[model samples]
Target chain A: MKEHATKAAAFIQDEARTNWHDESLWFVRSKRDKAAHGIPEWEQLRELASQIKDHTLSHLDEYLEAFEAKAKENGVTVHWAADAAEHNRIVHSILQEHNARRIVKSKSMLTEECGLNEYLEEQDMEVIDTDLGERIIQLKEEPPSHIVMPAIHLKKEEVGELFHQKLQTKKGATDPQYLTEAARQHLRQSFLQADAAITGVNFAIAETGGVVVCTNEGNADMGTHLAPLQIHCMGIEKILPKAEHLGVFTRLLARSATGQPSTIFTSHHHKAKEGGAMHIVIVDNGRTTQLGRPDFRNSLKCIRCGACMNTCPIYRRSGGHSYDSTVPGPIGSILTPGIDLKKYSGLPFASTLCGSCSDVCPVKIDIHEQLYKWRQIIAEEGHLPTAKKQSMVMAGKVLSRPGWYKMAGKSARWVTRWLPRPLIYNPLNTWGKARELPEAPKESFQEWYRKNRSAS
Target chain B: MSKAHILKAIQAAKPVPCPLPVVPVFEAETPPTREIFGSVAAQSGSRVVRAEDFVGLATAVRTIYPKDISIATPLRAIQSDIDLQQASPADLNGVDVAVIPAQLGVAENGAVWVTEADCVHRVLPFIAQHLVLVLPEDRIVRNMHEAYAQIKIDDTGFGVFIAGPSKTADIEQSLVIGAQGARSLTIILI
Candidate 1:
């Protein structure tokens, strides 16, 4: 994943809009914080939710079996996928079952992780992302930088140009609302024409064997309501056992995500209406592995509420695209390493370890603590860069012994004054770039503390 | 994640049916506790006040509803408000609110599950002007585990656990709620 990180860094540097992307998401994160902490019962709610997920994880085999049976009885086909590859294949098979050439899809971050659209394209299937932000990025032929706001990197002019070229708009027309409406009109036809609709499950009620799809544009409904075949993709973690949880999550989800009191559309596809066929592909894709690991399992409670990303200082500065995964920001930093240590080794280290993600987390996942844990795990696995490991070892050796600590503190002061500025600057550390390296004081705080202690 | 195929293969080799689920009946017939008002009064985004019986509750529902529109009881009884008997879903599109009975709660996520059983009718809430849900307060929980703990109950009817109102913010980063389901919700805490 070092290679991918390099590529992602290069991509981000070239975009020159990482800060804007970061800040935009951070704004959402702040709103989430306001909403979540605003509730007096917020912390209690989080604990209960966490315990429920733990309980679910322990008896997953039973719940999944029950869910499958109930869903089948409700006329929804349940497909199980062990991994991303299987998930993509199963989705394709479902589309093929109906010989659907064109499909309109809603926002399902799981599909992004599985690379579903690209895979379906390879199979000669036309899968158009109908979400407005998704459509913008799809037009640009880029991955969504932010999960909720896919085209956060694009400016109005850029979007106008893309629309002009693809949709043949009048040259230089940059009206966002007009372009959005036009896209809506254009996509509505696709929703109507498409034979199948593929959507992401927000929360699936095990009791009813139904999946809930939340959308602002009502695209999920426009497509699913019209399309004869519906394909729903969801992670195993989306299961919430009962329905009342929807009230808490839906209230908190929108408010935390964007400070909205509620989301525009929250449609539940219970038993498929009449002749419409519904197929749910529950993809694990490292979730149960994540679930079994007690430390990282709380991440499963994430409703993919990108609030943490929105509020993360590191994410806001570097941007979601910098994380280079389906899920990004503080949440991604932890989830990525669990998926592949080699590929996503840089993620955990990328964070500033600020507690904003956890603070803003509606379900209260200890995001920063997990990031810290991932760092130790990575270092233990020998994935740390040589320079970081060496620095840590040297610091450990000096700090553990008083004699070396005194000598090291004096040497560090001398080095700061004498070493060439260029030599002092570490290209290996991202912290050195842009941010000012604080000058070493004439005396260390520890030295002052010792003197004060003696005088007292 | 254990590959689903592994489970599938296990099923094929052993032909062992998964354990039959035991639906824990939470219906203890305990005396109804009506002393405390729930957080609904605060979060309902509408007026929530207690009522003694059907006469006062129905009277309150009528007062809360606009004079121009009609109201009805029973989730399945929504068809009388309009000639929706033959109205297709497309015809019933652009509904503002839906009031359906919640099956239970998963305090974990602050969600309230609802189902077909609690609605005025199948298409009632999804094809209406607004929704007003009257829930029994004892159903609330601390988190999802507590909710899950109680989910072993029988589900002989349709239900959903609505946390707040239907919502989303998927537009050009603009956060707009009340998309397809209901533009507003009025929870009458009876």
Candidate 2:
């Protein structure tokens, strides 16, 4: 019940548009469709990929062990963390060992989930976020709105203001190119001065003992090359069996997430630049419990592609802050429950059950299906209010018995017809401010169907 | 050091044996692509050509750089082909064109991936005033998934995916292409 997150949620709830957010996310999802549909073997490739991921998740312990062995041989030190606090401690210790005062980190949502930046900032270590969008939000000292485009909520003017305040650009100059150049120069100096670099693992190859970090702006390379030590933080689930699998994911990842053919994919191999050291920490905050559950295990196969987020109607409208987790959206709804159910009771109820997220998933993860399962889990745990359960039970009984259903349906139409649109909408829904609700007719569709059936 | 002594010293150096995965034979028969590749195109000012034969290849090469100008090739290529000679300091500074082979190509980013094999000292491309990449059209892939699908572990001794000739947005986000690499590229699709 952190008030900081609640304040963030309130801000997002005020700004999120059902239509625009859904459309924007769907637009990217469709770009993935176009890229994937053009390839006739796309379905087969997805099947192969799903199979590979499924196999890997089932044998994750074996592969992780194999990765640990191979990574050791490659001169990469391995660390394991059972929880976020342990993960943060291990990372901080590594930085301390390097005598690192200043550190540069790319967009690792895992670190964000762990609140590592806040933790380190508390310890008086300056952590600079290098990803352009991440940096924008970082400058503003706010949580990222979206995983891919962290600062998508902010416009260029807002970014200019943030940069002007943080980097101290000349007053009244807010050009994007100029701003980006300033950031590049400023970050370049930071990169050179940084003693260590931290990166999010895009893919961890067990066969090659390497980690792939896909970035569009080359920020990861800038920091990694300049720093003497490179530390990669990944969820235990990111492990892939071999280097060859990088293709299956790299092809589907960016197109699904951002409509790009691929993220400018960069893989770091061996140790950090000759004598430089590399450390990888594998973390399982709640993954073991997730792994034990067959129904929710497939959710772990996510490549961190934002496809589900983009396609989710509720997510687009309510915004990610409403989900109130390291990850958000339909995937987040199910994932949050696994990580912490009581705190995330409202998440499973957030979706419209549209199923577009599952349709657009490159790996064919049944996202909406998991949302449905999470609903059962939540209800079973008595997370739902007693009044809601009673009302739902009454409604279920009335619907199952066709006589009461017809009466209820007729009453619902009659009530909706009398209720003013404004009363039902802006004050309550609030979605109407940005998105329009469909106008319901005077008569119900079921009544029309009933009349037509009798006439035929 | 003489070649014999160097060979003896190389044998005397300790070999650090690490776990190497067995590379499975992958049959990569790339299909013809109509999508434009950026590295090859941007290198040659986004040049597109239709050449089905060797004569067409030569015509395309000569079209970019004249025949009187000697194109710089690698040390091994110079010894094998009499047409190319060992490039000197003058060639490094004055050579107008250099034709090099690429290790891979990614359609995902419109990148033609070349490596140190073509770079020699990472400067062979930079030092040359003008450049030409011998990108076989069939090497193009739609994304990195396909680009990485065909790789063997040993080939990364040194390699890079040259998306386009080195360009930088360092100076006020103005795209000044060919900052450190070749100022101009003429891609000969072989």
Candidate 3:
């Protein structure tokens, strides 16, 4: 795949759509701020959530064992997958045992990470994404652009056209209500006929051996309750030590996500419905690697609220599709590189180190700090592009010697002042491509400081 | 085997154990009130009705919904046109309105806690075109922390905190209520 910058450039070609995308995310961010301001204990909740996650990650092994034992007691099957391939295999085997060919799925980023829908399709099973945004993208044959708002990248007009072709809606209708009603009818049929339901776990409580799934539209409950067999796929990091901790997380989750006081439905599934089977797939998929990094272990504290994405300037302007990961935005920038450093090296550099993402993170993941750290690691591992590496090398040599630095600075100012516009604004000057060079000063700050202070 | 491998990896790579922080019950100057819950519920797209008794709740439900719609309920106080126990998941799909009892009500977000036992069919609360939750005024709590403290969440196979009617903003951030679940939610607090 191409780098994030290349993808971002392509995404920003349509200035009108890019500004709309940016404003839309900022609107959500403003709503989040309003919801957060309503609660006096918002910061306390973030701290408590962070600490609880820290404690849980520290004792993840015990929690997993406890969760597995209790789930077994509740008559639910617990499967562990060290990787995405194994996770998909386990899901397929279970489907084979039940002879289930038709499946309805709620939004699960873990399943997206595993490419479960594609894998199931390869096995000749009919898999449907029940979330309205997810269903739109599934029909459009693309991955979710944002974790929460899967179809945020697509305008209503585009969706209307896609539905016109796929769901046979009116040729040019652009009403979200009409489109949503059509999807509701279309997915309701899938839910009713589904042999199995698959959902993503928002929080898996070790004490209760249950998984909680939150949704604004109640698609997760619609699918899980109607289907005979239910499967909840969760990343290992989703575990919390106790059920009471849910109060802290849930209070923070929706408020941070869509700025709602709460999601429309927060369903807790402890056991299977009567005479039906329940299965929980705990997949690692490089979470342990993230957990091992002390600088990044706090990232596991994420509840996938998508708040960071809403608050991120780069994410808002560039669009989630620009990141080219299952999860896109600040959190994804830090997390994606750990999975494959060479391929995702550009992600950490996508940030401006503005720290807005960290400020807005519900669990207070130091997202920007981690992005900075990842850049260091990438450079140390020689993943930095040659042009950047050579320039940095030249910069370091000049900066280590004051005389050379002075000469270089003086020459740069002279060159900018005297050079022709085309020569200065050439293709090699990527920073100058979109920005005009600042006017050159006759005297440096050091020269001015010496002259001014000498009189004193 | 993967479980063992995963457990071992976690054991080896996990950070030093940290103490879990105490989650405090935030005390506002004034206790959470019914008015707060009602307004919040309205914001979330739910109609909140204050009733004096089950009779009043029944009247409110009847007043809000059309008389010809198919209503399902396990509450003896409210009349039902369909039997929940006999209704299969597919059969529940036809229910126009479902009135169910809530174990507890949360004042902070206008959410009502309903367990599987409250609705005989697990799908009743979601499958219905409109949802009616009868929450006793005395059972309402201040917040999620207080709500979790009072109830046994694991007592039933399934439970949910229903805040409002199902809604989504997936299409260009447009707020559209009644996505795939109930088109409307009416909470009758008695």
Quick one: best DockQ, which candidate? 3
Error of 3 at A341 (Å): 0.4
Cα lDDT tens digits, model 2, A1-456, are 532234435656544344445556566667767767656556766666777787776566667778888888877898888778988999999999999979999889999989999999999899999877788888888888778767655556677777788899876666766777677668766766788889988888787777777665656655665577889998878888887776676667766776655544344444555446789988877776776677887788887888888777667666676677778878888888888888887777777898988887777888899999998988888887566678878988997998898788777666556778766665545456557656557676776888888677
Q: Which ten-residue region of model 1 chain A has the weakest summed lDDT?
A: A1-10
In terms of DockQ, which candidate is stronger, 1 or 3? 3
What residue pairs are clashing in model 2? Answer: A247-B145, B41-B46, B43-B185, B44-B185, B108-B142
Q: Please give the ranking of all candidate structures by lDDT, highest first, separated by commas.
A: 3, 2, 1
Q: Give the better candidate number (1 or 2) by TM-score.
A: 2
Q: How far in Å is the alpha carbon of B181 misplaced in model 3? A: 0.3
Task: Give the Å shift of residue A150 in candidate 1.
Answer: 2.0
- What does the lDDT read for residue A80 in candidate 2? 84
For all the models shown, what interface RMSD does each have?
Answer: 7.6, 13.7, 0.7
| Model 2 Cα lDDT, one tens digit per residue, B1-190 | 2223322332342122223233222323554263546432443244544445535655666665665366666634322122333433223545556667765666545555665445443334544556666777777665555566666532442244544443333222234444434556555565
Every model's DockQ, to 2 decimals?
0.11, 0.08, 0.89
Question: In model 3, what lDDT does residue B23 have?
Answer: 84
The candidate, 1 or 2, that scores higher on lDDT is: 2
By DockQ: ranked, best first: 3, 1, 2
Model 3, residue B116: distance off in Å is 0.3
Positional deviation of A233 in candidate 3, in angstroms?
Answer: 0.6
Q: Count the backbone clashes (under 3 Å) in each candidate.
A: 60, 5, 0
